[model samples]
Target chain A: MSKYLLDKFLYTVDRDPELVERYREDPAGLVTWWESEMANSILNCHGDERSTWLAFTDEERTALREHDHVTLFEMGAHPFLTLTLFIAMFERDHGPLEYQIAYGKAMEHLTLPYPDIAT
Target chain B: MATVCAVIASTHHPFYYRASTSTGADRPPFADEWVAKIETFRETLTKARPDVLVMVGSDHFHQLWLDNMPQFLVGKAPYFDANWYNEEREFGLPRMTLAGDEELATHILRNGLDADFDLAFSNELRIDHSITCPIITLRPEADLPIVPIYTNIFAPPLPRPQRFVDLGKAIRAMVESWPSDKRVAIIGTGHLSLELGGPRQFGEHGPDPEFDRKAVEWIANGDLEGCCGDVTLDSLHLPGNATHGFMDFMLMMGVAGEGQKADHVDSLDLFHTMEAYFTWYPEGVPTP
Candidate 1:
């Protein structure tokens, strides 16, 4: 399912302020641009050292483009990454933890044992 | 030989710094009680007169990424620049730089490796709230030089719960044998029953209060036998998806040793999660 790539997308986007805003403002545009331009570029290495095989599945891309945390969790993308990035992007709109509470309630149907997050 | 003054474990709630420091209507109702409990907890370490600290905490995907994650890592730098931008954005944690004790970091790395643990070493490390949260709650002055140890509690394919306990025991031994006269306080922080990005998260209480109750009793009384018998990598998910972080507390239980009752134990049942603090005096309680 390329959960690692899904997490890598969240990890890279969450750390940069500009990217967080861009992703929030235009999820579809950011997702397309990230998959094409930034997906294979190794974090610490030069552009030439990029890994060629890393790409998101259609569902994974759709989940990111839609900002679908529920699908991300079901896909076993790292929960902490999803929660942190989502909070940064969305928490400001709501009053004091309202976003966090609603975020959890969204997946009320999911039960333990949650999806395995192992890479 | 160095004296292991205090073996302390706690919940590193990132929201604490903001909560405790806020004023007027901005301050949450629970801040006062949290601060009071923390002040009492802080005195447990202060009374011991520790000169150096061995800080045990896990990195929450800050500097160490999935590309090449280490199971256990020791930061051996001259200094550590604490807190991150995301932490600032989310938790409102201020930027801090704490002095690093390279000698103790070196001793732990060398001895920890010799003692059969393959630990990774970082010459430059920027720490996250896992380490700083305790620093804020317990030692606000942030004066003591520290040796930072990062564990992999967040990532999967994690080491067994037993490994965390074993490492704690090894750390206690290593510190006692460091050949320095400095009094060292070994401090570690982790969660009780946390659920992040799960259906059960951000609830009125922790995702599982029953688990939190049992977990606190296990730590307070130093019941590693009972704790280890019940806790497993797979079983931790029953309490909460993020409950694996409880292993860091188990690691401290190892440091406190079996049947070594904590001298100070306190808990605050805050919204979303419970905050528990524990302190054990390996060489008997220090005089105030």
Candidate 2:
């Protein structure tokens, strides 16, 4: 599981607002840096199937859009950070509720049932 | 000279309500019923007229981070502000302030250290939904000042359920020793079972209603030993990721005092999360 990546990503973002702002300013550069600085080390040391994530083609990296949130979640990303990243990336475009809905959808993808209670 | 002591507990999450609309198919069944139950408990709290509240809940990466999480952190600030993020505002939660009892909080910290519990103290702490939502529900008016105690239920190396109960006992002793005539109540807020961001995040088998019911029964009977002895970490985590929040209930049991049965118990099974409330009266008080 890439819980290490997810946890580190969440921890850094939650604690450092500047990192989040940098990410907002340059999503592609941040992703590239994350791949080189964070993900590469984790994958190299842990040696998981995610090793393939290192050699992503430029087109593949470009395709890594905001909608890939569920993919990240399924890959063992922390839910709080996954949602936080999603919000940071797309909250302006789709609004806040969209992120919440996306989280519910991602949780559904994980097979966790939503609580049957009114808002 | 502390007077009345009561335990108010609930399970809350920001996303639980955010994803669903107010009406139509999005609304879960018996939602109004759950609200009614909370309202009833709110009325019960108002009748008690507690001067101060000792709120026990866990922090969700708000005040503490993975690097410096404390097993037990007490707020010593005179005023605790709500950590309402923009995301939380989207769910209709407002940012607000609640009065904090600095003296009682300091006493609890000192007494806990004296009792050999290495407790962490925070002079400035922002509260998340874990306790804030319950405060809004149980004390919407925020009339009573609060002393918030944060337990480390999110991070690893979580204290044993028994430790929580023991901490509760320490808290009880501290509150009772206060040289004041103020009425004090303890509010423990958390879910029975919740698998947030875990592998079983969307799994139906994660929430066990039977387990929740049995837990309610144990609390109602004031069977702290039974709960501590029977409910293992594996059993709780097996049902959900954040089941560690159940430690809050154990803490509540400790505060309720020994042999003091819950005069009132109410529970609502919210599918993936079990919301429960229990009220324990002080010794020799007849249920009114």
Candidate 3:
């Protein structure tokens, strides 16, 4: 459960317009390509400085590939990153705040003591 | 020495920029009242007649990342390019450029490190909405040079609520001791019982109204002991997942000093979160 890696994917994609569109249009393709290419790259460093060992577990990969926010939340992926990225991709399809409200309702069954987001 | 003219604290709601500016049917029902409240709040800073602003806010994983995050950072540069692409996309926040008070930033960094804060300094920084929201509402001209101080409220292993208070006190002292004729208004923004991207988010009111009520009182009355006694890194989670942002308010409380009542206070109950505004005049309230 590499929450850090999960957040990196969300953070990296959320900031780039092209990545947001690509992830929205093709989640599985983006996830596969991101994992194979961008996941281990040090954000503030050059490409050659990228670390070699950072890889997401199968569950994390599946959650990202499916854009499953509920599962992402339960897995301790940062909720803010997940929500922001999801809203960017999907909010246009729904009415004002419809996507955000629905996103929360989906997690209504979950109680407090929500998954720890510490990295 | 620089005079501490006004110490202000507020909730940095990103929606305010869009809400207050939208016209006709595009504006939300609550926009009018929110604008009125902000106008009144803006007056507190305006009457103080500040020459420079010391803005305190946290980075929302914008420039600072987990790979290397600074608990407290000071932006020391000639200018700061404000708002991010994501902020513009999400909040309709216009891109801004504000002049940086490098002299004040240098003083804070030098004295802050000597004071054992181990502060990090950024030569070039793009500020997010936490700082800009207040600028839009209070100083829309974006005219004054500013020294931006960022705290780490979003990430875990955060500095304790008491630590925020201590830093606030330290900041106030640093400004007061600076050898300058400038009048500095220290402004910081944080949340009050907010829940973002969680089950209780986007509710009719903030997720925890009770917490917001107590938080307002603690800040307005400058009750640092009561606030820190009840608030901790662990206890903050109960009010709302994102309530740690409240520590920035505590930091402002420290600048206001313990038991010093705020000169101006107001609040607005909005859908997602409550907006609270406070201003303290260390040198008595200025007459308009």
Interface CA RMSD, all predictions: 0.5, 9.0, 0.6
TM-score of each: 0.99, 0.77, 0.99
Model 3 C-alpha lDDT per residue in residues B165-246, reported as the tens digit of each score: 9999999999999999999999999999988788999998999999999999999999998998999999899988898999
- Listed in order, the DockQ scores are 0.93, 0.13, 0.87
Q: Candidate 1 chain A vs. true chain A: TM-score?
A: 0.98
Put down candidate 2 lDDT per residue, A7-118, tens digits, no spaces.
5655555445566666777767776776666654442245553444534445334433344655555554445555555566556678424544545655554553322111
Report chain A TM-scores, every model.
Answer: 0.98, 0.53, 0.98
Order the numbered candidates by DockQ, best leading: 1, 3, 2
The pairs that clash in candidate 3 are none
Give the per-residue lDDT digits (tens) of candidate 3, residues A10-115: 9999999999999999999999999999998988788899899989899999999999999999998888999999999999999998999999999999897999
**Candidate rank order under lDDT:** 1, 3, 2
Q: Of the candidates numbered 1 and 3, which has the greater lDDT value?
A: 1
Model 1 regions lying over 4 Å from their true place: none
* CAPRI-style class, candidate 1: high
| Model 1: per-residue Cα lDDT over A10-60, one tens digit each | 999999999999999999999999999999999989898889998898999
In model 2, where do residues sit more than 4 Å from their true spots?
A1-6, A12-27, A32-79, A83-119, B13-29, B86-90, B202-206, B283-288
